[model samples]
Target: MHDVVIVGAGPAGLTAAMYCARGGKKTLVLGNTYSSQQSMGGLYENYPGFPDGIQGIELSERMLAQAQKFGAENQTEQVEKIVPLSNFFRLKTENWQYEARTVILAMGAGHRPLGVPGEKELTARGVSYCVHCDGALFRNKAVVVAGYGNGAARAVLYLANIAGKVHLLCTREKLVAESVYLERIKNLSNYTATFGAEITEIQGDDFVTAVGYKVGNTPRTVKADGVFVEMGMKPNADLAIALGLEMTPGGYVKVNRLNQETSMPGVYAAGDLTGGRLQVATAVGSGASAGISALQYLG
Candidate 1:
């Protein structure tokens, strides 16, 4: 049995592992290869100390290396279930099982995709969920931003600066966003936004060439190089739910704001799984807290 087991390889899990290992606790981090949502991002400008900005995948790798340097073992096996014992916890993954004195569930959320034909086949080949991440790829190219939520509106504005022409396929009759989003699109010269867009299919051979959408029953197709579907997020809380941990009404793992402790003793949760600001910085901060708390628990 190890001292601590962190069930993610994202920013939060890596930070927690680094702290726990450095504090003399044997720590193991179990996760998939592309575990962090940040890995799906591109040039992250908001993260501090990197004025030039850094790629999300690179940052995740750096965090992982740092955690390993501090003696945190990294495993790519995804956890399938967890069994809480009297004194420790047993984690079962695809290939192995581990027992740890303390457990930290850092499994972050995943992006909700737009269910449309060719979307699954065209992802990364011109179809993207994050405009902030993949927007740079469509620089100076015509692209379509779909949806009417705050995320979609923000994408329309952000891509207007990057893409040559941004056509918005608003899925609702009216934009369900703050006034700022609605007002900003009106000033864009290279942008056209319309409401009640029904995306029929994403047409492409090898790469995305156009988007098929409709304004009510009238069908239309817009030639574009990329499509950015800006829907909201869905938390990865299956393990938390199965563990019987207390959760927020929104289905996120509930944790103490002060120390990141969950409803159960010796168990902690951090990052998007706990449902906060959902920024990389906040995840790191909460992860540090979870690590320190795990150390304190062992004492």
Candidate 2:
């Protein structure tokens, strides 16, 4: 049995592993970078310590390498279920099972995909979910934003300055957003918005070349270099829910802010799963606290 088992491999989970392993605990991290929200991103200028900025994948690699250097074992497996027992927790995967004295939940949120043809195949090629991470790639080029609401409006405004032209496609008759966002979108010079615009397909061989959509029963296509799906994020909370843990009103795992402890005795949560400012820096901080708390609990 391991002393601590972290159920993620993102920045938060990797940081926790570093702490727990360095504290002389037998640590095992169960997750990988495949579904990481931050990986596959371009440049992150906001994270500190790297004034010149860093690639998301590189940053994740560095975090994982550091944790492994401290004797943390990483197994890339999908955890099927987590069972809390008398004094330990059992983690079941498709091929293996492990028990741990303490657990840290850091399963982060995921981007909502457009669910259209070529959407999945063209990810990182020309289709992206985060404008901030991939907008610079489309500089001076044309792109389409397939979404509505405040997130989509803000994306239109942000892309207006980067891309040569930005088009907003909404499936409704009118854009649904707060007045402030609507006002901001109206001021963009190189932006066009069409309501009742439904994206039928995202087409490209290697990179996105155009967007297929329909507006008011009229089929149309727009030549573009990138497609940004501004749909909101969905938190990975299935395990938390199944474990009967207390959750916040937003459906995120509730945790003690000071120690990152969950409602259960030896269970803790951190990162986007706890739902605060979902950023790498904040996640690292939360992970540090959770690791320390877990170590103290084992003492």
Measured by TM-score, the strongest candidate is 1
Give candidate 2's TM-score. Answer: 0.74
The TM-score measured for candidate 1 stands at 0.79
Write one digit per residue (lDDT tens) for candidate 2, span 27-102. 9999986457667554576799999989888999999999999999999997889999999999999999999999
What C-alpha lDDT do the candidate models reach, one value each? 0.89, 0.89
- Model 1 agreement with the true structure over 238-294: per-residue lDDT tens digits: 999999999999889999989999999999999989998888999999999999999
Q: In model 1, where is the ten-residue run with the lowest total lDDT?
A: 33-42
Off by over 4 Å in 1: 115-142, 148-165, 171-191, 195-226
TM-score, one value per model: 0.79, 0.74
